[model samples]
Target: MAIFEKTPQTKAILDDTEKLVCTIANAQNINKHTEYILRVHRGVSKEDKWNVSHRYRDFAALHGALQAARRDLPLPPKKLLGNMHPSFIAERQIALQNYINEVLKHTILALSLNVRCFLDPSNYPANLTEQALQTVSIALRGEGRYELKGPLPEIGWRIRKHYFMVTDTESHANCLLCWQSYGPDRHLCDKDLQTAFKCLQNLSHPHIDQILAIHNLETGAYVVRKVHETGTLRDMIYGTEYSKSYLSKYGNPKTRKPLTDGQIAHYGLQLLQALKFLHDKGLPHGHIHPGNIAIENQKVLLLDIENTLLGVANVHRPYIREHRKTSSAEAIDVYSFGRTLYEMALAETLEEPYCDIFPCNMSNDLVSVLRLCLSSSSCKHGMPTIESLLRHPLFSRPLVMGNGVHSDGATSLRVPSQLKEEIKMAVAVMEARLKAEQKLVRGAKREVRIQEILGSEEEMRKQKRRAKKRESVWKSTSSLAETVRSQSVSTASSPTPPHHTSDAPACTNGSSSTSASSAPLASPVAAGGTQQTKVTNEAPATNGRSALLSAICSFDKTRLSRINSE
Candidate 1:
């Protein structure tokens, strides 16, 4: 079945694991799970007991009396299950209970998943409506020996249930992941399922995990996806390497060195490129963070993309599409992701005490953009953007590392350049916006506040722009970095060459310019017989190269603006 088509939950179930559970449950003698009401032709029927009877004993007695009364009666056509014996009713009751219990469990898994639930990988009947009836006949005939069959069963399930031992403190949802399933999942609303399925199938990315298949079983359509046995990013941060530095950031004390700046940049770039690709498809990898990302197939793979959607364009999709009651849309998800990103990225953003000089952990240009994304409607400042952030001085040059405010060695994860540039430019546009505000903070100076305000406004506008830009740039950067990284790794003993046109022009020589004031715009501004140099320090490391390039480009573009302002 096509993943996009929205169909009712007819023959939907994961697998036979539920039946196993039911077998065990019957052995224990617990009441049937009555949540699923019986509809029979409609779905799982919920009518209680036989006829109007509620108690099991009453059902047994009623059926028993009827059988006894008809003892001499021409033996009611012995076609259905071993013609009713004296105790057949009681046996039938137990068998029906078993069937109901097993079906219920399987149904639950297909409906929703949590730590305690998962999908079963198994076969199902082609025609789901009569799956149980067909199964008995098929089993009696010894597998494929049945020759009197008409059309074969097309869609149904082999899914059953099993009793899973769970704990009180740890919820069932904390562990189980779906291995497979059938049809429209209750929790995975049609919209989300369709969107996620499309993303999983159509993305066709090498770094992304490929969906193996989509099935159209009678239970409904289901999908098969690749699983990474390795682990998740969260497992690494909380449990493994690069832990020591991050220990201080949290209450837990652990020792592990943070990833080197280079590593962060490398992975961060990959993420941005991936997001860019999604954007190109009129979608957004809304949840773009280290935890949601994975290293697989020798590259990073984005997980949980089914939860995301097209960027700003879909902000108002609910109003347009008369479908699911979705209070939470993809845009909201993106904004939420941005908040998460502010916490996980480099030290500067993490240590943000004031809005003015919020460091551009990615590219200086993207800080403003990141800021806009970081802003909320409740905040006095408006939304930020990528292009404006790019214009900010933070992105105008490469970033310097050592300004961490967190103690106990809080290692910084470099914001990806794609993110960096996107945010920086966004922030610039946001900060410069002339939007009217109701009131102002009493203590903050207008001059100082103006910069913050203007910077914020400019960044907001730029962020929207960056979201639309081609993500291929990230791939281009990755290709270049990979070449450099491999070559650099191989030539560990060799002395590195001098800075040149190939390296950074402004930073060719180590002594190029440590101070931002040394740029062409760093001329003397005379005041009271003294030339007061407005100093802006460049961020350290590879970020510096990015900033230097940005600065050169900005300078080249704004000759007219600079001349006019001067």
Candidate 2:
């Protein structure tokens, strides 16, 4: 007897969907109610744009509940006492923007059952929305998990509710990092994902922040990474480093404790090792600075290297790009590392364009290392290599270690304890002297303030031309340095060496002049090409023309006109 068996209906698999990005369009006050106008979209296209409005109080309540529910997540601090003040309101608005970023990051990290319910207001009981808006105690409900079939079942993370422990379904603990992903277009996102995964997968080091997983959704993918609690090295040096607007709202501390000489040495050695490894594998770190370094467990870790492949330019500051353009890819790493070393050694921030003389009162050995590293000319065969940095005297027990006696016909390189102690004391004295000098500089800050007031478009254009001329002078100096390096290399190869000062010609006051040695000149030969020609410092004819150019470069038309009228 054949019996007709009823088949069970199965739920359809959820398709991968595009990530939703929320940007604050405006915030307005209406009848004492603060309304946030947020624009949401999947990608750059305007087809699926959604503009949603919510009361400021709703965000405050959401923040409160999120704090209570997910202690693991770090949300921007909420302002309670002075919410109506203009300054406080402005600050809160920026914080709210940052809060949206954090929320989106968290949602992208793990889209579990609870996360879906938290995001979709429709899933909430009609009364729950009202309750959530009213009570700070009400937290979102649902667990975070992969909606589609995967290798593991229910391995996900989510914000906790009433119970501190996640329910029986959750298989993974709450993660510390809030991952962010973007898809300008579906095809582009896929292409970027594949490229990023391919590049990042081969990189594995103790100092590098490793990619744990790359989770793909229908329209985008999440690149999950781990971050330390100590935060970025930039945060350690400066009180905080964020967007300019964010910084203006919440003033960062002007100064922070600089890493000690011993600490810097330790960090440098490890980082140098990582650089050598990367370079050997034919991968340029692309970015290397204190800001990109992460400190965790008293160790130095590299962060944000994967962004280069994601189409996120490593152009943090304009000058960084300009400087990097002047050198090869691997050399950029060395050049940036040198700047980072200078900052760490001095325990202060550097104003760029590559200062030849540092403000810090450090040992000459330290200074020499910095000079070589800063010079773009040093990236060649004759310059100090990353491997050579491992054996630098600065990393030795003493800053200056004299020749040691031979041991079994070989020299003893080990430093004595007494010598090490003396070097430490010497560094400490120099640091104290620098701190005193810095105090004086800080005291005269108000007197040094000279704000330029540009009144007309013509004046603005003149100022721009002067700025361009100034940039041209610096570029000439870089070319001069490279030329000197090439000459030195060629001279070294010859049997008889001629007397040549390796002192790099400096561009001061927007004009370049060599002392005893002739510096190379970089003049515009074509729209994009610069012709390098040798120029002597003592040449009267060249000096006359240079002086004329300098006069034009330094002239402030508006100021001169006002002075003439007076």
Candidate 3:
């Protein structure tokens, strides 16, 4: 009577689940943009798949699965989840009650104590385990309490938009932990998720995928993520077009080599910098691959964190019979990361130059570290840390080396006296990071205090929250009204891209065609490869007259050096 037998509706739901979960290239999402499916349309289309029936059935099955594990594992505490917001706790209670009343007849106390959990992807702690996910309780809306559900597995589901991913009940219990123990941190759950989704949100390293806002409502919490268009990196590099272009850019021009030593070093360094940023934060992406690396608007993004492993073994839910030993579990991630690097690099070079002709592109010297990892004996050298790989002899070298600084030699990415300024900027970045972290800790602590106090007095808390939410809505409405009012004032403002006047030409030669634009356009190099970056072109013509574009096409490398050294 519990688990579903063969039914058209159930089968349909299962099919949708498979499609969403198994789809290649593109990561999927709950199509909340679409109208909610009514009872009749519930399994009719893919868009209708996330309806009430689907959640109910999924939760039921999850609970059944977790109950089987409860005999052996005790549920972990709430702090293991992450920053949960008090408003979220209250909101979920209100939402859950409304949603459940329509389907199940259960009292709050009889079912689950109203608890909110926060699961942190930050530093992914190992204290939480598979058993921890099993038999956790979920809050029943009617009674404002929790009942045993299933384990919160990090498997497919997300909660509160960016907290713990549980396939079972403990995730439910963990949600409560935020409500009960750390009130303020819990309150931030919504904000944390929301802030993460906001664009140009340069908090995480450039690569790591971001979390947006967590929407906790009547039914469940929805973890929000960004919309990716170009699909995953795995599908990209493996495809024919991406591979070819990648090679042409990085490969030798004459031999059409797959990649030059310089190019390998450059791309490898980029990956290293990205990884270092994550690892230093104690966030080692357990699943680093081209597939997880997404490209949005030409920006590289590391996606899929639910499987991301941190410093510990207990954080990830294992599908296969995994080595429960923490060391082995953690070590496995490094190898996986290494292999993924190899796969991406290999795919990037799987072209003609790389395979046969180009000696440079196919050189074994390329990404020696990744090549070592790909060899049958991955991590054979006592599993060198990512830190070590970053500092490896090969990785530390410059991308496109020419000659040495001391000797009578040439160089690339010129070094000059002005480099002192860049150093200052880099130092400032470090100081800013420390200050930001301190502020975050203080803020989270303050919220925790407010939540604890508010949590104790429920009826009063409810009234205040309502007033606040309503106030927010009013403010939003008022802002919109103000925008409408300002629509008249917009006549004073002009909207246009700043274009050059007649005297100033877009190209040095003033040619309209950018494709045929002079060599100086590619770089500020002079005609004879001298760095003359400051070589200003002749003044633009005052009259509506044309001039030869050849003058604009000139470059001076010596000028470039002076600008750098300045």
By TM-score, highest first, what's the ranking?
2, 1, 3
lDDT of each: 0.35, 0.48, 0.35
Off by over 4 Å in 2: 1-172, 176-203, 215-221, 239-251, 315-317, 375-385, 396-566
Evaluate model 2: give its TM-score. Answer: 0.38
TM-score of 1: 0.30
**Candidate 3 Cα misplacement greater than 4 A, ranges:** 1-202, 215-221, 240-265, 296-299, 306-330, 348-361, 376-381, 400-566
Can you give the lDDT of residue 487 in candidate 2? 99
Error of 2 at 243 (Å): 14
* Highest lDDT scorer: 2
Which candidate's TM-score is highest?
Answer: 2
- List the candidate 1 regions with Cα displacement exceeding 4 Å: 1-202, 215-223, 227-229, 240-261, 296-298, 308-337, 346-370, 376-566
The TM-score, computed over Cα atoms with residue i paired to residue i, of candidate 3 is 0.29
Name the better of 1 and 2 by lDDT.
2
Would you give me the overall lDDT of model 1? Answer: 0.35
Locate the minimum summed-lDDT window of 10 residues in model 2. Answer: 155-164
